[model samples]
Target: MKKLVVTLALSLLGATAFAQPLSPEAKTRTLETLQQAIARRAFVPGVDFSKLPDALEKRRAELDKAEDMRAFSNTVNQVLRDFGISHIRLFTPAAAQQRRTGQAIGFGLGMAPAPDGLAVSTLAPGSHAAGVGLAIGDVITEVEGKPAGNNPTSVDQDGRETSLITVKRKADGAQKHVMLLRKPYSTIRKPTLTWPAPGVARFTLPSFTNGYSQPEVDALFAEVAKAKAKALIVDLRNNGGGLVNNSAHLLSLLLPPGTPTGCSVTRQMVAEYKEKTGKESSDPIEVAKWKGPDRKTTLRKLPPYQGKVVVLINRGSASASEIVSSVLREERKSLVIGQPSAGAVLTSIFAPLPTGFEVQLPLSDYITPKGVRLEKNPIKPDVEVANALPAKEEASDPCVLAALKALTK
Candidate 1:
């Protein structure tokens, strides 16, 4: 009888082993570190940082009063809203780690703004979502048992970080719940290339930073060159952007040598200029010399794709994605299709917090060659498709079909 009881107890213990929650100490540490990091690293270009002390102190008080990690996250996000800018955000621990290390959390699913709510638009093949019958047209109504309407993505209290998603499907108005393990999605790990139509090559560029290296970017273009594609379609529809250098590398393959990509204004450089010159000039031309030049010594040797290029963008396309699209539209003469981008073009650093979460604090602002700030003002597509999401089937993508027809014309 003692042996039987012992075995049952062991089983129970094993079952509950993955259910650890963050302790109060961990919560406190996380809040304190987040406060410090934001104060030290967060910058709003053209706004004085000294004027933010009162707000920061109030946010700190709110953090102290928070009862749990979710409350703490809510308070921190509320404070971030004061900046009134994009790109600065506090990511969940799982998401923070993903951005920091290029890992992914939850099933390989991508969401887009739908009329009803955020809809699942893309799914990684053979992914957990796919295995569990999660399909496109399913709107995510709740995540982790909360109404997910603009709610920050979160993990369960259990240590597994598994995401419990409540989905409402549009096909038959059916609702279902799914459990997805936190793992890297394969879409952004490599380029998705296909020939959607004759002589038109389509490459889905999910992210500039995720898993793809410089050699891989070169290899991608080399394959494009081999296809002898007369027209190219680059997909940035759901991409949330990535490394700036990688975007530049991709743009270099389409642009002529010595093309001016854009310019950036960092908080440190601004502070130094004020300290040294004691003058604050908001004029971009006054600081145009600081604009980084795209000097390519070998781009001339590579046969640039001298074809009509079309870029697809949506509300999820942001940061480095915006930069590339804006420059390509103005410089390389690429036609943009789809809705406006997310306009999160600022340069930011992902500073990890004590509780394993990370804060993306923007330290610089990027200005396009035409003197446009890519913060709240996104790059509008030449052919503006309505925000309505397409059906799950590939043939249903109106943007892709439109691009093909445009290329043929």
Candidate 2:
């Protein structure tokens, strides 16, 4: 089965901790592996990579100047940015391991860029951040007396250091300082089910990545089936996608058996396609006919959900989340509410590099059953609503309110 690492937030804090500067030999090896992978696996049609070798050579000076893995990754990413695509990125070994295991060696906090500084978007329960009384929506103004720019943990030392963090509370503008010790913690937030209203069941699926529990998902689906809710609200906001199999399973539960969700077009498929048609075609309908893996056929062992469906998404909803939302919207006549989804959908896999470095490269292009290419084409919600920081409690979230209101109508 094809796995997708679609989460923009997958590379979290402590990515630089324990990182060592790459030796001259290691840098050369990394560059070689990266170049070869792109040439062999990358499947963005019409994107010219003829200059990639020249570009990497041109950046050799910068790569040599990289003092740490993060710096090295940034230099490599700068070259990759030329591709103008998503799902292709370099990760430090620390970050790569965190992405796969959902564990990080830092104060467990999910942050996003705020006008003032990085804001606490998510705080894992029992984490050092949570234990220190950090709350969501709190803007981190400073870290260790330095102005907290984007990354608050840029100074962290592999879970062995403590730093004073200045935070402006969301409830009030009051600022406070707290010393937080970095430690290991789980970053996985499991899928949760709740009844928002009479006959309305809401499932907040945070992620579909590896390390996400399959039994948990099965149990949640069972609950939804047992609830017999007339309307089901699937909250996929901020869910960066994971395994394609997980997505197929989720679709199987909501969609009819044998329904076509989508298919992946690999480099081999592209080659054969162009050979047969005498030219390359970017149209999804044409690509769907090529021999490749179909998502819908990999259904999990579960009964199809028989209920009115509504999906909630935001800019962070991507990959498998985008696929699920799009398929529901198209096949089940489900109402998709909220902001536009993250247009980073593609099938990618992670490959290890020398010296504890890794790269995620897209090997296939994804097209929905309806011929819509979701790579750069974000899913526009039927009922567009501006996204906001969710309320401290899910019961009072504006997005959920909007979804419930729509369901009632």
The candidate that achieves the highest TM-score relative to the unseen native structure: 2
- lDDT string, candidate 2, 342-396, tens digits: 7888787777765667788777778887778888889999888754455567777
What C-alpha lDDT, on a 0 to 100 scale, does residue 342 get in candidate 2?
A: 77
Q: Report lDDT (CA) for all predictions.
A: 0.66, 0.76
Q: Clashing residue pairs, candidate 2? A: none
Give per-model CA RMSD.
9.3, 3.3
Candidate 1 lDDT for residue 247 = 77
Predict model 1's lDDT versus the native.
0.66
Q: Can you give the lDDT of residue 401 in candidate 2? A: 87
Across 105-191, the per-residue lDDT of candidate 1 in tens digits comes to 445666655555557766666556767887766888777788766422332333354778788976788888888775544444566
Off by over 4 Å in 2: 1-16, 143-163, 282-286, 289-293, 297-301
- Candidate 1 lDDT trough over 10 residues, lowest sum: 5-14
Q: Relative to the unseen true structure, what is the Cα RMSD of model 2?
A: 3.3
lDDT, residue 369, model 2 = 79
Q: What are the runs in model 1 whose C-alpha is more than 4 Å off?
A: 1-36, 51-53, 65-70, 104-113, 122-127, 140-188, 268-279, 282-286, 289-301, 353-355, 387-392
